[model samples]
Target: MTVSPSLSLAQRLRLWVSRPAGPPAKAVQFDRALTPWAFLVPQLAIVVIFFYWPSAQAVTSSFYLEDPFGFGATFVGLDNYADLSRSNEYRQIAGFTAFFSAVVTALALGLGLLLAVKADKVIRAAGPYKTALISVYAIAPPVAALIGMMLFDLHIGPATQFAALFGYDLRVGIDYWDTAFALIVISVWKQVPYNFIFFLSGLQSVPVSVREAALIDARSGWRRFVDVTLPLLAPTAFFLLIINVTYALFDTFGIIDVIVKDKPANNPMTLVYKVYLDGFKGNDIGGSSAQSVVLMVLVAVLTVVQFRLLERRVHYG
Candidate 1:
């Protein structure tokens, strides 16, 4: 590697320039096939074990008659589903489910969007408003239910006392509609924060110039919102509709458990709760599995229908 002292400075410079950059600095290759997969193994295993395995077992168990004890299982073809098809109670449960899901989705999305709009309009101290709103989301389902329970407890609840002040008795458990209202309140309470976050994010994405232009050209604020802002929010609204439906179906399990004093009563039972009531509580494993399968189908169908039908109307901003 020694250079000749006899060579001129220009010659030395030329020689140095002519030398290669030493094996291209061993260009690092990130094309390893196994590294990405090595990272994904744990997640894949967890999904398979927790989600797919149980789903498969539920499907399999739905097709057979399982003994109360874990040992004996007999293939019952479609009898469990057949019994469900003929049951008047199952039909009523389905009806209640449809109504409850629709109401929850509407209340959650509507109130959330309204709250988000008001929050968006706030010119001062928005942090406190958002924090207060989101604190409800952090409340655990059982805890939230318990709080609602205490608030509406028949004998010693502030809510009942507040109603008494208005000359109306608001008993939580003793009245069917009152109980229904409480469940709806809890369901809506849990969903509003989630919907608020999404809707606020959506609203913030709308350009201020668009709002300004709408306001300048349109006669009124309501007209501008209807023509411009609401259309742009259609996609967000539609997305939330799907989530709210799924939440109504499945995610309200704990809320229902804590809120309903009478599980056997028809007032507050959804399909998800019915599955638990039948399977774990009643030990009708086969029938409950079938019911679970039916619920799974219903949810899948509902999602598909909403996406297909509503996506056509959505305006992506």
Candidate 2:
């Protein structure tokens, strides 16, 4: 193709960019084929060492009853799995884990979106407002749980003291339901900033022209948001839904550990934490390995379902 004689440099550049018919090109090439493998070896080694190795060992260990002190093992076949299937405590913990994950993901995503919308509308002191909101996420999960413990510390905690005004006693770390409430609150608080950052970025990425069209088409702000903004944000929302579910399942271990304070006897715990407790504290390696395998399957199934079914409604622009 030939450029017009009158075309400016910027117009010429645009024409070049728009001309898309071409084979793919590689930017970098290695003199030897082994060079590419050399570059990949480190990352591949790390994945094998950290992920695949442990997974294989866990699968092997699950079928055997081994001494906690590194002694000989007896093959137990499916006994460990059978024990988990029949345990009432394991069923209760599974129920709590499902409830906890659902509640935390919902509250975190909802509050994050709400805050992002409000922050997007702020013209003055936006930096400080966002900084204040985002700083909470920088605190580690265990640290957040520690702060939560203090807030519900029964005697001098402001939250605990405030409960006295309503003639209600707040007994966190003691009462099962109260401790669960604290766990949910801390988990949501720890996760909201991450969700907020994503939601705010998604909101900001809406084209100004699209916003103007939406405004003209729908006079009501809520209607415009529901009809226009939400569809555009669907991809981001779907991605965050997966991330938040995984976070609730695995990343909240520190928070639960700190809240329970090494004593999970009377407190609510997630399945992941129960694995650690049984493995390390109770010295039941075979059972913990079996539990870990079950969790791995559960997570895999959940991910497949999310991708296969839940992703149907996500419309990416």
TM-score of 1: 0.85
lDDT of 1 at 117: 86
Q: Per-residue error at 226 for model 2, in Å?
A: 1.1
Instruction: State the C-alpha lDDT per candidate.
Output: 0.81, 0.86
Error of 1 at 264 (Å): 2.8
Please provide TM-scores, in order, for all candidate models, with all chains considered together.
0.85, 0.89
Error of 2 at 168 (Å): 0.9
For model 2, how does the per-residue alpha-carbon lDDT over 141-252 read when each residue is reduced to its tens digit? Answer: 9999888888888887888888889998888889999899999999999999988888888888898999899989999989988999889988778778877878888889
Lowest-scoring 10 consecutive residues by lDDT in candidate 2? 1-10
Cα-based lDDT at residue 200, candidate 1? 85
| Counted clashes in each candidate structure | 0, 0
Per-residue alpha-carbon lDDT of candidate 1 for residues 181-248, written as tens digits (9 for 90 to 100):
88898889888998898788788888889878887899887887789889998877766776677778
Indicate which candidate wins on lDDT. 2
Winning candidate number (TM-score)? 2
